[model samples]
Target: MDFYQTDPTLENYWRGVILFGRNVASYKFALAHALYEVDKSGSDLVTLEDLAVPFSRHLCQHLLHAPKQITSRGSQYLETCVQFNNGEITQDKLIETTVRLGFSNVIDAFHNVNAGEIEKRFFLDERKTAKGIRLTDNFFQLSERPQYQNLVYETNARWNLVEQAWAMGVSRNLVTVEFDEQEQLLFSHINARRVNITSCRDSLNGYQKGRCFYCFRTISLIPGDSELADVDHFIPWMARNEVNNINGVWNLVLACQCCNRGEAGKFAHLPSRKLLQRLHARNEYFVQSKLPLHETIVNQTGNQTTQRKDFLEKNWQAAKNNRLFHTWEPKAEGEATF
Candidate 1:
């Protein structure tokens, strides 16, 4: 069975990640797109060498841009490949990293390789016709899944929006400005991250199947409902300086207005262990979504699951240490049974 179809919470978790998360190199999204395209003929088999051509082209066009003239170093790994565009790195290195990084990222994000410390025998799996691995049955099914398609669309759309916003801001900058104009432009785009909450809610509500992220209560998206939806910073926006990109999709969750503004809601408090588990499970669903969010989270936190959990735990401790404590009290009637 497609778990996303059966599990509303899992599905919503993915939507939250794809729509709201900050992406770096977009390896996860690129890999999925390539697989979906090559498998469009309905074959479960795919060639890594063949995939590299299209995947490389897509990343180069969309992601492998020059380092920011001032602020960002571009994506950490991809920037190494940017030297290829500037005639600095060898084509062989470019091709090698393209295939290796893409393959590793897909496996890392989806296979939970680090969880088991597997030997990566799967990457070397090959067939007579092509030097490539077969798609996992789970992934093969996901290639044809509509939810997966939505994930790709949302991930690319968000990247395009941020890129365009940055480009627009840069294009309008004046040479006379004394401040790092490009940095200013980048921050301007970053600031727009806050606006994504409302813009993404319509689709997020559908992905969440109209349930609040915290309380799991049925939330109203219908016109003129008294109990409207609210976009909550799951980690609380008040911790912005302490947490990186607090407004990004990873930290944002849909909540009922009550849970958002209630005395106990997000008032600089870390959630209970149960809620933290829900958040972790939700993030795991994002990995299964086979989109950039998976790689994004892995990159943001550590590569290992324990590391990611520890990272969240540290953030929670930081909140408590700073005295930002507000206990989340799920209402008896407000919580969903699931």
Candidate 2:
């Protein structure tokens, strides 16, 4: 329940994990075993809080046999929490209570963390709780209210890209530019707004409401809220080798920041037009149906995928010739009608 703050050295280590992998799921997958295993002299574990409930560091101590600092802090705290100079097994003894009690709360915490959108919903500072994420309370609470169920269902149907944009905005979002070795501090020569990237995103948002055309996560909540809507390339920029082609409007979607930064670029170079067409067609079908959109995706995925593919193919040559994913626009929502 109580803890020491992360010192500079350990703070850098955690930041490296955050910056490099760009998501907590990637970080957790990377940190699994070292977190639990015993070491010869000491372990690399440290106590921290669960995300929303930051004050509850020991909330999940049941998982750690003997939860203590893994990284270095000061001298006194280490002696009491870690190796006993007397060679007693207090370290192992404390952690054992969890294993002995049959409480799965601790391990389940780890699993819930790795479960996608569940992790990105809030801050993960451990002085809070050793737990790493915030659950979708707003999303769920809104969903349960019949008045908002339709909106919530539609929102959750496209949650992945939605969450991704929110994550990019909340975390480290990179702006791309062609720079010479002399260009330092990035902002010196970078015309971020003039790049007209926002205009591109706006165009898409003009159509899709700044929500991701793919997933519905809002893309611009975090600090500095770097253009949550990004100009995406339907084709890989590297593959095309043409700058003009890279920023074309036809090639773009005003998707949530997550789709722009994380999803589209990671697994595929650009999102398939077929996917968009499917998303659109499916959305239209859901709107007409008596059932919620979430249920629609679940029930009609196979058919939607096929029709979507067919629709995209019919427009395939035109979309490719026009270069569809090259630009982006902000999302439009509520009464702030753009």
Among these predictions, the greatest lDDT belongs to 1
Residue-level lDDT tens digits of model 1 in 203-262: 345445457887777665544666667766677767766776555545556688767788
RMSD of each: 11.4, 19.7
Q: How accurate is candidate 1 locally (lDDT)?
A: 0.52
- lDDT against the true structure, per candidate, is 0.52, 0.31
Range of the 10 consecutive residues with the lowest summed lDDT in candidate 1: 174-183
